[model samples]
Target: MLVIEHIPAAIADEILVGKERDTVVMTAEERRWGRRRLRSSAGRAVALALATGTTLAPGAIIAVEPTWYLQVEAAAEPVLAVRPRRCGWFRSGRCRARSSCASWRH
Candidate 1:
C-alpha cells in the first residue's frame, strides 16, 4: 500500500523488479513494523523522565520514524584553548587576570 521512491536506481530495480532478491516485499513490511516500534520507545522515554522528576521538560526525537524521546539539555560548549582576555594592557589587546589593573605601556 505504501509507495516509496527516491531510492537509487539499482536498489529500486532490485526491490521492485524482484530481479535480485526474493524477499522484496518483506523489506517494506519490516520498515513499517520498525516505525511502530519507534513510537512505543519514544513514549517510554517520556514516561521515564516524568516518573523521575517533579518538574519535567518533554522532548522527542524524530529519526526515520517519529518515535523516540531524547532528553534535551542546554549546555555551553567551551573552547579547548585558553583564550587571552581582551583588555587594553595585554598582548593582542588581551589581558589575562581577574582583577582590574593600571594599563601597562611599553
Candidate 2:
C-alpha cells in the first residue's frame, strides 16, 4: 500500500491498498538530522511534477542511480589528504600526515 506521512494510515490503506510506500519511519531525533524538508530546487521540481501529473518514471530511475555520487564525494574528502593502503594495513603501515603528525605519532 502507498504509505504517506501525516495522513492517517487507515485512509492511506484505503487509497493505496496495493500501491507503494511514500514515507519511511524514523525516530523523532533522527528525523531532524537524517531527514530534511523538501525545499531545495530538486524538491520543488519533484513537487511541481507531481502536481502537474507528469511522469517521473524514467527521470526517477536516472536520479536514483546518481544519488550515491554526492555521498561518495563527501566520504572521499578526508582521504584526499592522506594515503590509501591495503585494507588491512592501516594500523601497521606508515602514513604521511597532512598537517599534524599526531595521527602517526602513536
TM-scores for all candidates: the values are 0.16, 0.20
In model 2, the runs with Cα more than 4 Å from the true position are 1-12, 31-35, 38-106
lDDT of 1 at 96: 46
Cα lDDT tens digits for candidate 1, 4-93:
221222222222332221112112223333222221322331112122212222221211112211222222344568634544556654
| TM-score, cand. 2 | 0.20
RMSD per candidate (Å) reads: 17.1, 14.7
Q: How much is 101 displaced in model 1, in angstroms?
A: 5.0
- The alpha-carbon deviation from the true structure for residue 11 of candidate 1, after best TM-score superposition, in angstroms, is 46
Least accurate stretch of 10 residues (summed lDDT) in model 2? 66-75
Q: How accurate is candidate 1 locally (lDDT)?
A: 0.27
Give me the displacement of residue 44 in model 2, in angstroms. 12
Q: Could you give candidate 2's per-residue lDDT for residues 1-106 as a string of tens digits?
A: 1111221112322443444322222233322332133232222211121222222221121111112100001111223375533333346553343334345434
Which candidate should be chosen as best, given lDDT against the real structure?
1
